[model samples]
Target: MLQQVSFPLRTECPPGACVCERERLLAEPDADLRPLRLTRMEEQKLIDRIEGIASYEELKRLQDRIRTNLGVELKITPSPNEVRTLRGIVILLEDRPGLCKKVRQSIPAAVRKALERHPEITYAILDANDLFGM
Candidate 1:
């Protein structure tokens, strides 16, 4: 009589040679994905900046600036369901595969903070894999 054991396959590709999305995502530091905690003044300034946004181009510019300054990616758009109001905005924290555990865990708090500070933004959603949807 003989006994045999099976082994699970490696899910991750080797470093430097990985071409998969997960590998690329894992390469980025979690710190970059996580938004910095700002002071009350800084938070107010950020909200003020967002509050005065009058056009899509301006919003896009702010998004670029945030990405450049904070290394945190954000997408802003008009709320699909709420149309007749100027303040009906949706803030989406862009999502992708292979985000580190720390970054993934921080997303909900990030969304909450975003919503709490800006009444202009009606919804803050996590795109792609929707943890909040669960």
Candidate 2:
């Protein structure tokens, strides 16, 4: 079983000293720790939610939302320089079972618009089914 305990606050650092701290903390060791535990009912609820994600667009929205929830800086715009190089933010939404698209050709113009805006997007496979390929 999990338990909670409390301790008194203690700090030696001076005020106004932790500016730009996110970068420093990120750079520090073992910052990638996010603990998660789920009860049986919660696990079943999560399974149901995953099963209910119906469409590609819904998947994208969910992914973007999760990033927002996690305080991640998202890059919705991808560059258009695939021939030269591949770089930029690429958010993949989901891998629906038995659904796949190899190229961005089949993607709607609405989705392609992000890639067209910036020439700096070196390469974007941007497969709709590939979640957060970055």
TM-score for each prediction?
0.37, 0.26
Off by over 4 Å in 2: 1-34, 65-134
Q: Per the 3 Å backbone cut-off, how many clashing residue pairs does candidate 1 have?
A: 0
Please, what are the lDDT tens digits per residue for candidate 2 over residues 1-134?
Answer: 21231322112124454232333333445442111122234334533543455444554574465345323322343444333323344434332211112211122222334344433221323553243555
Which candidate's lDDT is highest? 1
Off by over 4 Å in 1: 1-34, 77-90, 94-134
Model 1, CA-based lDDT: 0.45
Error of 1 at 59 (Å): 0.6
Report every candidate's CA lDDT: 0.45, 0.34
Best by TM-score: 1
**Cα-based lDDT at residue 72, candidate 2:** 32
Task: Give, for candidate 2, the lowest lDDT window spanning 10 residues.
Answer: 97-106
